[model samples]
Target: MLKHKCLDQCIACTACTVQCPVTAAAREFAGPKMVGPALERFRLFDQDIEISADYCTNCKNCDITCPSSVPVSLFSTLAKAQYRRQNGKSLRDWILVNGEMFARLASPVASFANITMNNAVVRTMLRAVGIADRPLPKYAEKNFYRQFAELKQQRFPDKVVFFPGCYIGYNDPRVGMDLVAILQASRYEVIVPDVVCCGTPAVANGYLELAEEKARRNLRELRRWAREGWPIVTCCTSCGLTLRQEYCELFRANGADEVASQHYDAGEFLLEMLEQGRLNSEFIPLAGKYLYHAPCHLRAQGIGLPSLELLQSIPGCEVNVADAGCCGIAGSYGFKKDKYDIAMKIGERLFTKIKDSQADMVVTECGTCRIQIEYATGVKAVHPVSLFKQALRFDWVG
Candidate 1:
């Protein structure tokens, strides 16, 4: 639906404004309902575009909070793309949008690049180009796709396809490896297909055309796997949201609805397995209470807190839900130097909650969220899948 069409659903509710984290963090940001659906009402009359739309992190907080089911973030993103096309974009936009290309380039210099990017000179240059000064996620020695080929697992008749998003594939292949270990434990053959980067960062950065192209490729792969009776799963919350909802909501990619229906967040998939009495309930005890921060995108899926619930179920574990809100690193929003302050301010609650709790460590499903947590709070953060594999002492991979 167009912005005009979505505007008709609103009855002037202020709920979105009240719940908007960006608005709370950066006072200048016109909160969701106004900059999003409300501004669309003006666009219906062919008015000028909304400049405030660019400030939206596209976190879908408005969509999640809307009582009227308005696609609030869609309007903002569409407007953003339209504005970008008219005014052109920055070089940083090009780099940030093509997440896969950047990951590939960084892979070759993985170790040195990680060390180099931490310096004042590099950070000064990055800030000039709109990138933040903070330490970015380091590229892994090998991406998940390359690492997948190197792992030897016990094969089984049952099969499942795993979509290792750019973050998991490039920054943290261990999480991907952990999921593989757990799947092998469940006696299922893991299939790693040629899926694109879900194009979430692309869409968020206003590269709508590139995002659609990436989505089309992923859709084709997802359809093929679905046809062969392979259930698709993902560990990254943003990637899963892009595959399962954003493609349809933002880009309107062909066959996206079907692909979305066949998708599952990895933790949610495991919870389903638990309910079905098929999960491998082996013994190994993790002796401490861990804090679990649910990413906004995962909550936007409306699937409840699967990772937190699953962690709590472990006999030797206690999972404490963080007393916080959004982590503020919504895709690449926080990576821009201009927006870094807002992201940090928005995340202060979460960082404080982590410090106050003083849990042994922090765990979250989103890779960016994990990075933000570790960067801000100096607490070791990881994907629950990694924790699961380590706690269970799964011998296949660490």
Candidate 2:
């Protein structure tokens, strides 16, 4: 189905080929334009080779730059599904694809689990499971749901539910905390929802049934919030995109469309607040420069540089946009051992750009991008919510 749709529109024009940052940086790797449609043909004819589908970071650059508006990322994902169906799933695939199960199973004694994960023996185990040499995030001592449950109850002018996704809820609760603080400062009643996985990782690994199950569960939960007139607010770009686009596709044949239409990212929601004059803060002078790496999913949503507008609103802050494209850390793509070298090589251009910028900090909306850029550049990368939360302190309501 991915290939049936007009290959002629491509003209083999190679606009996408040239625009691809990954192809330009990693000479060994074939560009998305070539790989996407080629894999579709590969699925048609020769289905024996278990070619590594993990190489693609799912950066969406090829789709973004394509003149034909070909959904290269979508095509690649579908092709991966076809490939995996023939080759069979790996043990590592089972672990990564069912990441929600691992997280829930580890939740009761998260600290112990965290300790074990950090241990040398466990690190080696993880390496055996295909994770690279990168350090894993420790589980928070207190999860986001528990923390939000304790917040003082206050009725506000507008209400919205927060879906912190699995990563922020368990690993980095501070992102959710800071997001709540910013929303409360803007006079919105933030409702913290009990949400599980968004299943982006599962879909990427070709676990369609598992991904569908997770999507249905999340859709029911989100639909309840929608019925209560609360828009689903998300901090993670991947989660937002999954809820907005992919979930709808999962239910498209079944004719359940409304489940996927109810999500918004913090940046898009903040931009709306700015437009509506609901968010007001005194621009505090914070003398520093920042380089912003826009996440692929965020760009896919068609909201351009709202993060830049928010950052620039901070007085005395100079925001330098990174010309370098995808950070090459597409969720857990860079964390796998086999792909780590290619991921680093693909990200080298972005790394060089950040080094040359001499910026004080790197800012991005996506948590994974923050981690990757920080790992690659050795610069403190923070979420835009943190900066806005800092600025909110200056605007004390009498």
Candidate 3:
């Protein structure tokens, strides 16, 4: 019940509402200004919360757009959590929020899980429970931790701890491998820590207490490495944002400030190495035009398009910033039946732009953003770190 001081900074500028993609796409939404700061005033007085707060995708566009640095999305997210506490949450939300549990249970029988997940009967059953009709991200046969256990890596004096998060650890282990290769080539030993999900899924789904539990668990390990001077890195922008911003902002997690100070997006970390004249420059020319989509979470970090900047460093690489705005996935937000259409509607502008660009590939830092891009536009989407790894090793097969 700790009230945020950010709520006091709202000046009724309406800039947040103007930049709110959800408000623009879905007319039913009361806009971030009204649902967030405005309703927060009543909530502080123990008044009933408005239902419109649930429409917020928690994409953080409002946070990025606020001139006064008001955390509009935080307010909306908390309201959603409080409302759920009173009314109770659905089974669909319970399943969606516990990503780490699902990943661990499914990874052992990945092929069967993947096949069963897409079957008509399973899809129908899932849809009946309010899961979306869209395709789900397939589970990897071997999760990132298992793959990394068998990985042969050269030891370096300079080491960095990597938080793979659930997406890379469960669905796409290859991205993690690519990141390891990239870091190794730059003479840094990669350390994959034993950490839980960054708890974004829980926070977004109104499980605030669960998110705090996760934050504390992760901070125990992350804060240790952070204090030891090993830079903590994550390839997923959402994970980065949650660890560096949300843990402190929403949960007031202890040692979050220290961990946030050391946390960096993989590309952001590499970009810093480049700026400091320490990044490996042995990358061969990679000739391809890639359209890059900046995830709303990455933008919310207030770091200027680090992945886009990193990708541009490759010789002969033509990287264009799509700048079309949010992909609208917002982690598990798009996977709910009720929010799926709204998510797609919010992404229409970006989808249209990608289809017209006809780039060799679409690159981004968020796993869900890549999924949405490919599903909506029929374009292959990959993480920026994967492309950088290819460029570094001259491994482009095309």
Best by lDDT: 3
lDDT of 3 at 354: 92
- List ranges where model 1 is wrong by over 4 Å: 119-121, 393-398
Per-candidate local distance difference test: 0.85, 0.75, 0.88
Q: What is the lDDT of candidate 1?
A: 0.85
Range of the 10 consecutive residues with the lowest summed lDDT in candidate 3:
389-398
lDDT of 1 by residue, 1-398 (tens): 46556688887888988888998988778888887777776765658565788888988888899998888888778788888988898888787887788788888788887888787888888788889877788899877777888888788989988999898888899899889888888888899888878888888877899988999998887887776667889999998898889888866777788778888899998888878978775657778879999999998999999988778767788789995989998879989888999999999999999999989899999999988999999999989988876666444542
TM-score, per-candidate, Cα-based: 0.96, 0.90, 0.96
- Alpha carbon lDDT at 230, candidate 1: 73
Tens-place lDDT per residue, model 3, 284-347, is: 8989889999998888898888888888888999999898988888889899999999999999
Root-mean-square deviation (CA) per prediction = 1.7, 2.8, 2.1
Clashes of 1: 0
How many clashing residue pairs appear in each of the predictions shown?
0, 0, 0
Local lDDT at 353 for model 3: 93
Candidate 2 residue lDDT tens string, 48-112: 25454445666667777777877776656766776777768888778766666777677768889
What is the overall TM-score of model 3 with all chains considered together? 0.96
After the best TM-score superposition of candidate 2, give how far the Cα of residue 98 lies from its true spot, in angstroms: 3.0
